[model samples]
Target: MRLISSSISLATAAALLSACATLPQGTSRDSTNTGLDVRTRYVGLTSDAEVAEILASPLGEEAAVRLALFNDHTLRARYDQLAITEADLRATGLLPVSDGARTPEAGIALPVLDIFLIPLRNKQGITIPERIEIEVTDHAVALIADVRRAWTRLAVAKQAHNLAKMSENIARAAEKVAVELADKGNLPADELVARKIAVANAEHAVIMAESERREAREDLAGLLGVDLMGDWFVHNADPATIPADLNAVDMQAVMDNSLALASSKAEVARVGASHGITDISSILPDIDLAVSAERDDHQWEVGPSIEMPVPVFNFDGPKREKAEADVRAAQYEYAHSLVVTANRAALLVRERDAAHKLVKLLNEQVTVAADQAVAASLRQYNAMQTGVFGLLAIRENAVEARRHQLQGWQRYRNAEVAVDAARAGVILPLKN
Candidate 1:
């Protein structure tokens, strides 16, 4: 019977040990979509499909913006940082304390006296979470600023593409004119060659413009958490239509809303002071309950616990200094950012105003040049005294005027984008 019992106990022990030693299988540990790679979806999209979908599909813009929001690796990392800080805050709030031990001894020969003592454990208070919260808030604000910048870039790219298309149309017309003049033996071969070169350059410019537009779309898509390969397009919203009115903004009022700086300063102070003080709490039985136990000859005693850390080696001296320095650094950075933003806004506004003036001047010049070219051409052609050189010169002047007008228009658009960027407190709309 004893041998049978021993065998049963050994078998039970082995089963328990096996259960404890076994680990979960790969399938059990795997998460939803664990084997799939999200990035592959983007890589699978052909360049032509990307461009065609962006230009033709209604979902293009939405997908692009969403990709920027979610798939952009950089933004994803920032989100992860924010999550970590949130977890840290939760951990800080729960402040764990170690349990104390109790031991009992019989009162030997002395029947009238009973003695009991409990060892106390000391715990130092932690205040790093408050500082961490401040840092996280600052990071969040910076991330928002980054998003604004990326969006501005996206907007600028779209405008550039539009301008490039316009330029390409003009270049094609000029090329046709050059070919006709060359066939009539009225223009030199060199002039025809120049026009052909201009056409090629314009075509190249269009290709570059398309590339930039694609990059901007991808950037914005990443920021908005959309698939890069997804069909989407950004609506060509005229950012220039928005007017900048200084009266609409109260600088002082806006400055007052810097909560990150304020919180950081407060946190620094809170953390520094907390480092010098110890947090104390009790987990002892009630005195009345102890007295009740005393009547049963197993007397319980009320124990006082002292929790403290001996500041022999690490007194958090360096840590306090670092915290104070961080507060100052944050203040400085906040101030600097405000100043830089204001300066940039002012500069962009001035640039836009200048570009608008230039555009107006170019428009007037184009009108006057067009009238001159028409009058010159008609007089020379009707009088039958028109030289090839004179006719070609006038036509060339008209073409140059048109080119200048186109350039002015492009500049105006660019300036408008700049002004919008300034007002929006960002340089580009597409998130990098």
Candidate 2:
């Protein structure tokens, strides 16, 4: 009975000890940790009036800028790349191997027999993070360039929309005048039909302009991680004309200013130089304490951990060649981009100069046409030598002259925008 009670007590104690050992290792709650929720609110449906109000509000420009910041798929993808690189950086800091152990015990009454046990552990150094960092830095520079490119495109779209709006207004005025003359029978019915056709054409222009504006807005919104259909307006100052003087710009100098290509070359050279070095370390044996009835024995052992690659079969020959080729390719691309940009700038400058000259000539023509039409109308009206048809014809000529002048101005503005974009390496403001 006493032996049975002792066995039961020992079992109960062992069960309690096992339960304690099986408990979780850490506390469930921590003061510094907080749950994160990434839900975003979308803008509600808005009317034209509401859109106008939103545009007037300060939030509209904020939203526009935010859209530029967030909605870009390229920029967003870069962010993900940055995250992946960061994780790789963390992983690189960790050692490649870790320690582990196991133990076993048994009761026996045999003599002249013994059991042996083995323990194992491993340690190695990691050095790939440094290389990863260099690559990631290069990627960051490229991301900045992408952002600038997207912003320039958005600005261009807005300017185009403004030009289209001005054209629409001119078309509307012409249509109104044509309708009035036709109603009075001073103009042929076909003239009014032509005017209606012009109205339809002008409406189509407006639609196209709106479509472009929406596309730009959506692109910017996507970059910002915002809803593309959100009510927002861009408030920018009127675009400035390109300067008349571009003779001082050296095309060759601009072409040599590529930092990305330079960085890539430098990194490829550095990594190639370090490719042969391998990480190696050694581990000191550990001491274990034990209690025994008579005495205790201690043993020590030493081991080396080597992490060198065997160059007999693979010496990174292929990888080094690839890196050298990449450097050459990057240099070529940088040179090419510079040449293309400079040539485009030169062409745009010439085009702008021609457009300015044309606009000047058209302005003078409009003035002369206006005077001639007015003089003709006054003479006919004073002498009663012409009917309403003659007067209406003179008026229509003046209106047409004005329309031509508007068109010349629009063309000149567009040419100027192109010049500005080329010169500044970015998009210019809209010419309202």
Candidate 3:
């Protein structure tokens, strides 16, 4: 009786889920003991008002990241979806044998052999939680990258547009000079007309550039999940580098944090448990116990009865083979993830370094050349050594050079963001 009671208690304890999962808030932030990626940090907002307040302020790169982490409805919905796993636990429906049979039974939680099965117990206890939390970290990494890249584009657009406006001023000045030369008959009719055409092109370019700037701001705002109509502002154009903490990059860290590997590992646990259940079902006999009390011609009888199913055909063979195959498949999937992650990490590192060098080269050399070009052109025009068109061309080239230089800086910053996300910290490695 004590043994049966203990078994009943065990089964009940394993299968109840009263609430859904949520992001850890407050002081428990990023607690690594749960097997989730340690680098994922989030702050949950209590209401739409808090999000509004953040949006009201000048949103910096880091602030934008924080808002997206907590404010995005799609992300929150994904976190809530983990609760669906609880439904699977409930599907057994307490297994209460309410029909009046010889065996009168009542138990805690419920007594279902499958729930109490060794394999299922292990999966419910460990693997499911690990898999869900892997997704938490995965989503966070992707969202943060989005914030960084969008913020960079917004900043670059504003800078580029301002640069374009400055170029227009130079074009306008060239047009004025052409007007003066034409009045004196020193400049040809075609040359003055060409100067007017140059001014017109520069003005059109500024308008297009401004339109792009607004669109970039809108995109950045949308990612932040602020009110669509609210005014947008950026606190930092350049995203700060997320420094790596490890003395050396460890592949193990990424593997531990990979969602894909976590899913496969969970599958392995589930199948291994299924394999155990099948093996037990084939080998062990099912014992049915019943007790009854009755008055038959003033005679009372109450005793326990036992019945078993004979093992005619062993059922574990095909199931065992299938479980073995599943295990092999999961192992191969894990191996593939590792290889892909390593290759990705190497590629991001190379591109980041190259991008950094390219941006530096543009800043150090191109800007200087552009300045000299403008100065020499101005000197030549004043000395009448070059025509108005020649002077305008030099100035136009300088402005275009500046535009490319700004774009190069934006690309370098974006590359750094990619590398940072790809690194995912040693605490949260890209899972192989």
Candidate 4:
């Protein structure tokens, strides 16, 4: 007797789980607020004006990341996904009901198996929104890593282009002197030809450097959503001398925060929920109850009937096996993700430390030595103790040393960014 009255609750839950194949188009303001709130919780910046302020001047790595967050359409779409998932969660929690009237004999038909599984379904519905939110944050952190990498490349490209121009100038001057000496019969023709070849090679280096700079600039521009026609510049600041303290890091916290690990954990939980539901559903038969009224000879009779399927051929054996296997696979995946995330964090920290040490060595010892060598050679040339060619050779060596120093800085900065990303729960490739 109470089954007829309780059927509405089961019907509503079933509708909540399976209804709404088509949601309303476009994001709601509330969903946008939720996305923005999550972003602010992680990114710290709250307004577009903050990003605009950073973009108004020279682009720093931080500014580049901020600009990308504010301008990238792909990131906006990710935020929109957060909104969409939130809508689904809300809709599932508040099951929609129609106001249309029902006939006296009209009664909801609910699978008896589903009556036991609605709680698990509700739990999963709640978990999905939380998982999607984590994914959104993961995407945002990934974008920041990408922007930082592009900024580093553009900075290095500019430095290389300047070095190439300096080399070109040196080669042109050497060739001019060689031409004059050859005209005066003071230099061999072959040596003059060699100087010309050196000039041509320097020109080629300049061209290649310019091309690289252009490509780097375009890549950074695309990330920042900025026009290439603008006079934006990146500061070529030296990387930090000190390395991050790896010993103080909490490995468990790092793994917990990792995007890959979190996604895997969510999957395991979701599959476990379904596995539990299916485990119970397999032991129970599919049954339904119907209430109807019949009138005959000006008399009305009301009765309730119970209907159940006999398990002669299908006993849910395959379904239960599948559920158990799915749960085991999800658990294994989560375990694998945990191991990979821990290893990745350790490796990135080690690499960052190594990069810092290399940069410090280049700055303190090798670069200073190269500079001193150049100065000594210049002084020797002024005293006529060294020829112009010898001075130029020493200068080239100094430039090479500087190039190595700059490259070391690039590697160190990129490594630092990657370490930061790992700490922030996103893994990014270290720039070479």
lDDT (CA) per prediction: 0.42, 0.40, 0.54, 0.61
lDDT of 2 by residue, 260-379 (tens): 323333343344345432221111111111121232265433321112222222335787566445444433443344334545556656666676676666566665777687788879
**Weakest 10 consecutive residues, lDDT, candidate 2?**
112-121
Cα error, residue 204 of model 4, in Å, equals 0.9
Better of 1 and 2 by TM-score: 1
Tens-digit per-residue lDDT, 137-248, candidate 1: 3332333344444555566567677666766666777778879998999789998998789779879988997898788777666565556686555554443343343223
What digit string (tens of lDDT, one per residue) describes model 3 on residues 208-275? 99998889888887887776667757764432232322123333443333345445445544554555
Evaluate residue 367 in candidate 3 and report its C-alpha lDDT on the 0 to 100 scale.
74
Compared with the true structure, the alpha-carbon lDDT of candidate 3 equals: 0.54
Question: Model 3, residue 423: what's the lDDT?
Answer: 42
Question: How does residue 78 of candidate 4 score in lDDT?
Answer: 59
Winner of 1 and 4 under TM-score:
4
Give the runs in model 3 whose Cα sits over 4 Å from its true position.
Answer: 1-57, 78-128, 236-252, 276-321, 372-394, 425-432
lDDT of 4 at 158: 92
Candidate numbers, best TM-score first, in rank order: 4, 3, 1, 2
Clashes found in each candidate (C-alpha, N, C closer than 3 A): 34, 7, 3, 0
The TM-score measured for candidate 1 stands at 0.44
Q: Write the per-residue lDDT of candidate 4 for residues 26-51, one digit (tens) a residue.
A: 23334334222333322334676665
TM-score of each: 0.44, 0.40, 0.61, 0.70
Please give the distance, in angstroms, between residue 322's alpha carbon in candidate 4 and its true position after superposition. Answer: 3.9
